[model samples]
Target chain A: MNIIETVSLALRSLRSNNLRTFLSVLGVMVGVGAVISVISVGMSAQAEIARNISDLGTNIVSVLPNFRDSASQSRLLQMMNVGLGREMLEAVPALSSVSAVAQVEATLAVGGDTARATLMGVEPSYSKIIPTDTAFGRWLVIADLSVHSQVIVLSSSIASELFRGIDPVGKQVWVTAGERRRPFVVVGVTEAEEDEPASGAGRQAFIPVTTMVYRLLPARNVSMYLGQTRSASDTDAAVAQLRRFLSLKSVDPDAFEVSSQQALLDAMKKVTIIVTSMLTVIAGISLVVSGLGIMNTLLTAVAERTREIGVRKSLGARNDDIRAQFLVESVVLSSLGGMAGMALGYAGSMAVSKALNWPPAFNWLSVVTAMGFSTLIGLAFGVYPATRASSMDPVTALRCE
Target chain B: MLKLERIVKDYDAGDIHVRALGGIDLHVTRGDYLAIMGPSGSGKSTLMHIMGCLDRPTSGSYLLNGRDVSRMNDAALARIRNREIGFVFQQFNLLPRETLQANVEVPLMYAGLGARQRHRMSADALRRMGILDRAHHRPSEVSGGQRQRAAIARALVNSPSLVLADEPTGNLDSRTGREILDILDSLNSEGVTVIVVTHDSEVGRRARRIINLKDGLIDSVEAAADEHH
Candidate 1:
């Protein structure tokens, strides 16, 4: 018999009993839907995290001090004790590949504004090394350094809060320390990042490292930090130079922790990828369960049609022909269920994307895998029932109730 | 032509060997109308089963058209049953779920005939039985006589050489049974071998030859040349 005829006959049989077929296909629908929903959420979350991390510049490296001091000192004083001082910053620029250096911390004033901001201390090359866009006035110039200019750059949030929507450029602000503190002129105002760290958003300030070390916080020691790199290919060279210089200055490499932003981002993505793949595999187990449901249904079908089997056998249908008929029926049912499930999965993914406000993207590989899985399920589950039906004896089957 | 030589069919009922057929000799030529008569448990049905190749004789050689069919496999027997013999059971064994036309098409379906040819043959067979208009009606919707006629139509649809009727009229009324017997009489006269197994003497006496079996053995063989046919 032709496959078309067999499929039609099988479909007709299934159609004759609508509730049973629907319940059977329902298993596949739920399995495919679960798989789609999980993969979509994982992929979207991964993409979002990767984008957020990459927004930080890839070439930049951060150096945080290992603060270990006696309890008698304040926390800020202890932090200052762990820092690499002005000697390291002065030594870095003389090296051929060293690009720029900057360091930042908080100094709070309760009089004019209660908010505390990062008190950045940097050299003239800080603007050139980092891609900080100036919104108003000018960046710190070389003339400022020659004239010993004690000038500060106010970030947008600090400018708005401290100056009350007025441009704070050219304004003199006193950043008070214990006894000796000086007034610094605000030369420029830089645009603030929207998603700045919670600790760095309220009061804006910047000045020369020489001025900050000599003037404000004179009682506490502050560190000199490096934040720059060479070209992409020279990244390793820059890191090696810094390591060698730090080793020459300090007794142990454990005195500081050095990390690259790009390395951190890559590591996070790798971990997320592994987690997503594991979740996908767990979802795949449902498909296998759906296949088992199809097998059970087909086995029951054989049992119910014993008399029909006998009639067909007595009429001279070959064993292969009987097997083929039942097998064709099973495959057709499973394929139909698969097709329905794929459609449902597509719709489900689209719904999730709408809910999450992410771009809607369909994975065709998922459809292919679903189809292949359904076909295999049909074949694997259909074999036992087909064999049982074909192996029945005409005499005993005819006598069956 | 068909021949059964000293057929013996023994059934093992636990430890006892109950003989269903005992050294029975029978011969049937082309276009013969023969009836085997016996009461219940007289082994008339067993003999019919052996003659139709649906069952095997324990120690007999069955020759169909001079070909030994006694040792044939089940598949070979099925092929022979589909091609060379037609059976009409006491219950008028039409498929209850199929339409009359589809029921008549069953034999041709196993014959590997194309759909169009099978349909045409089934419709023609129904028309011969004068139930062509009831072709689309299921067996449950049709009368007992109509169902039996439809069964007879299906039996003859393959144009087999022999028609084995095992109590064909047992489920029909007397009038309907006479009508069916008339159909069988006409089929026999048209050169088809007909073997009717009946307990009714009136139905048995209509055949050209009657063989009476008792206790799994042939009690007597009588030739009634003055039958209706």
Candidate 2:
């Protein structure tokens, strides 16, 4: 018989047993739905990480002293004393700008209110390497470092804490470290970064690196150097150049660590892949379970329809016809479940992304893969039952009640 | 025409072999109306099954319309059943879930007819059976007589050379049984070979020829006078 007739026969049987049909396909629907939703969620997290990395400037690279041991720390301190940041800029031609960073803990006294905060000393190029906008006044300029100006830039939270409801620009604050206190005028108040507030963007104060090293914290050493490439695409080359320069300047090749945003992105991509595969495996288990469900249901259906098989056989339906009828029924069941699962998965991903305020990432490849896999599952699980139905003897089957 | 020579059918019931039909020889010409009558376990059902091609004889030479079908495979027998013979069981055997029209269309569907042609032929068969108005009604929704008529329509829809009925009127009242026999009589008059297996003498009286089966063998064959008088 033709496909249409086979399909009609299958559909007629399914329609007569609607609840059984629905129950039989539910496993496939849930499995596919879970797979799709998990894939979309993974893609969304991947995109979020990528966006954060790009937000940190893809063209920027950071070089930090590897202070694994006290010996290396002392060596790194001695290297910092010799102005390694300037030497790095002079050695790497791919680097457009470089900034040195020194950090210390200090108490700030402003209008008789004391707030302890991390004091970061950096060059004017630091603003360019890690882009930030000022909510109030101007950022430190090259002239400010050349003249050892006593000017400070406060994060929005620090500014509010130090000088509540009033603009802190041009106001004097005392930075007391150890037995010395230095007066500095606030130059700018940096805008708040809501997404990454914990990344030292809300409670720190910035001053010229020269002022910090020569005046406030005379014994402090530079902790890290931030470098920017001439173009975003040249970040890898710039990192290599910086690594070579730092290795030549240091006693050990592993004394300094240099990394770019691309390195971070690669690491994040690895994590995303692992997570995606892990979720896929879990979903695969569900799919297999559902495949078993299909097998079980179809076997029961074959048993239940033995008389019908006999009737059809006596009416001239060949064994192949009966087999095709059952096979088509299962395929229809799984494919229909797959379609419904796809829709459910899409909605699930959208709901999760909305709840988490994440961008919804739809992967068409996952959709296609899920659909193809579900169809394959149907065919794979449909074989035994169809064979059983087709192999039944017409005489014995007709004698069945 | 159908011919059977020394047909034997054996069944293995547990370790004991049961001979359901023993060396039965029969011949039926085209347009012949025949009835088979016997008590239960007299091999009447077995004979009907073998005649309808639903069972294979253990040893026999059977021919239908000049084609030897005795040693044919199940698939080949299915083709013969689809194209050469139609069956109406005592239970009506109408698919309870399908409408009368779909029930009639089953054999034609197995015959590989297209949907449009199958519909037309099924409707025509139902019309001929005088149950066209109930074509869309499922078997469960109709009375026993209507269901049997629908079964007859299914049997005739494929236009087979022979129509076999196993107690076609066993589940019906006398009036409905007579109505079904009348339809069978008219079909036989229209040059279609009809065979009925029944225990009811009233049903046997309607056939032109009757074979009484006893203990897996034919006891006697009777030819009746024309009922027109």
Candidate 3:
């Protein structure tokens, strides 16, 4: 039989038992849908992480206290006691500039509304070094750090949650830390971050490092230091120099960790790739299982249609014609199911990405990979059944009732 | 139109070899009407299957229209069947889910004819069998006689040179069976070769010639003394 006749014949047979057709199609649909959703969600998360890393700037380096040194020590406690000296950072020729990074948990209250926030204390030049964009008002100035001005910059999440529609800048908010509550005026509001949860938690309030160390803390200390290399190519040299400079200052080499932004970006990319591949393999096995379902259905069809096959054979149909009929049927089954799955996976990924606060990924690679996998599964599973139908003896088959 | 010589068919039921057709020789001319009749296990069905080209005899030299088809491959045998033969079964054998018109178009579909030609040919065959009005109805929706007529329509759709009917009227009432016999009478009168395989003498009596088989070999061959078409 020709291609058109064979396809129509297959379709007619499938239509006669629509429940069977639907069940087989449903198996393939679920398999393809899961793979598509997983790949798209993974791709979107990977993209968001890459963008966030790039936003941190390529030439930047972070010098953090190695919390892995002692598992008994809490991160917050170790972070509070960390103090990177200015002399140690300025000694490195590769490091063109450095800024102090410190943090403390504090409660901010405005009239009846109160919210807990992490107070991030940094140098006034931190904004210049890290490209910090404010949603309103202005960033910290040099005079604010020198004069120990009691000013605060709220993150957009905290600004919206604590002050609602009221302009947060120029408003007075009480900062309570270490059994002391003092009024500090809001100077600016930072732009909302992409990775923040939908619940508007993880709020940060930024202030000058000098104001935090002199006025808020009983001891003078900073948590960490952020350094900027003169060029992207100088990032590795700056990281090495910072580590050496710390060891020369009588600090243990294992006590502090220094890493460049590029290293972190590569590590994050590798981790995402590993995670996506693992998920695809898991979803791929489901596709293989659905393929087996298709094979079982087709085998049953061959058994039930023995007489029809016999009739066709007597009507001068070659063995190839019978084989083509069943093969085309399975391919059609998978193609239809695959198309529906693609649409479902697209919508599912979008919904999930919306919940996770990442942009919905539209990668054609995922679509191509899913479609190829589903169709190949159909072909692979269809062969045995098609061959069985084609090889039957007309006399025996007609006698099958 | 067809010749068979020294035809022997054997079946291997695991251990014992049972011979079905034992060295039978037969000849059928063009425009002939013949009947094959025998008791159960008399090998009449085996002979009919061989005659229909649905099975290869264990040892035989069969010639159809002067072509040695005994040694042909599956594809070649299929082509021969498409161009030279048509079949009618006792159960009507129409695809249950398809309309009568599509059922009738099966032979032409295997022949690789285009839709326009297949539709035209099946329509003509259906009209000839007086089933034109019920062309769109499925086999189950039609009466037994109408279903058999549709089967006859399918058998004639490709205009094959020979027609084989196996117990054509076995499932019909006497009146409906008479209707089918009359149609076969007219078809033979129009110079088409017809071979009917049945045990019913009533059906055998209508043929111009009859062959009787006992066990595996032909027992007798007789020309009907009286005939009407």
**Clash list (residue pairs), candidate 1:** none
Backbone collision tally, model 1: 0
Please write out the lDDT profile of model 1 over residues A84-174, one tens digit for every residue: 4334444444222222233445554423673467776666656654556679877776576445577877777666666777777877666
Identify the superior model by DockQ, candidate 1 or candidate 3: 3
- Residue range A184-286, candidate 2, lDDT tens digits: 9998989986863543323678889888888888676777888898998889888888878778778578988899988899899899989998998899889
For model 2, the superposed segments whose C-alpha errors exceed 4 Å read A1-9, A105-109, A112-118, A160-165, A176-181, A192-202, B225-229
Compared with the true structure, what per-residue lDDT tens digits does model 2 show for residues B15-128?
A: 999998999999999999999999999999999888988888999888888888888998899999999888888888778789999999988888888889999999999999
What tens digits encode model 3's per-residue C-alpha lDDT throughout A1-401?
56777778788888988998898888888888889999999899888888888888888888777666345235323443324446645687777767887788898889998888888888766886687789998888778888889999988888887789899999999998877788899999988877554333367888888888888876566777888888889988888888887766534676677898889988998999899889989988888898998999899999999999899898898999888889998887877778888888888889989998887896788889889988888888988999999999988887778
Q: Please name the candidate that would achieve the greatest lDDT relative to the true structure.
A: 2
Between candidates 1 and 2, name the one with more favorable TM-score. 2
Q: What is the lDDT of candidate 1?
A: 0.74
Positional deviation of A23 in candidate 1, in angstroms? 1.2
The CAPRI quality class of candidate 3 comes to medium
* Cα shift from native, residue A276, model 2 (Å): 1.1
Identify the runs in model 1 with alpha carbons over 4 angstroms from their true place: A39-277, A358-361, B1-26, B34-78, B85-98, B164-166, B195-226
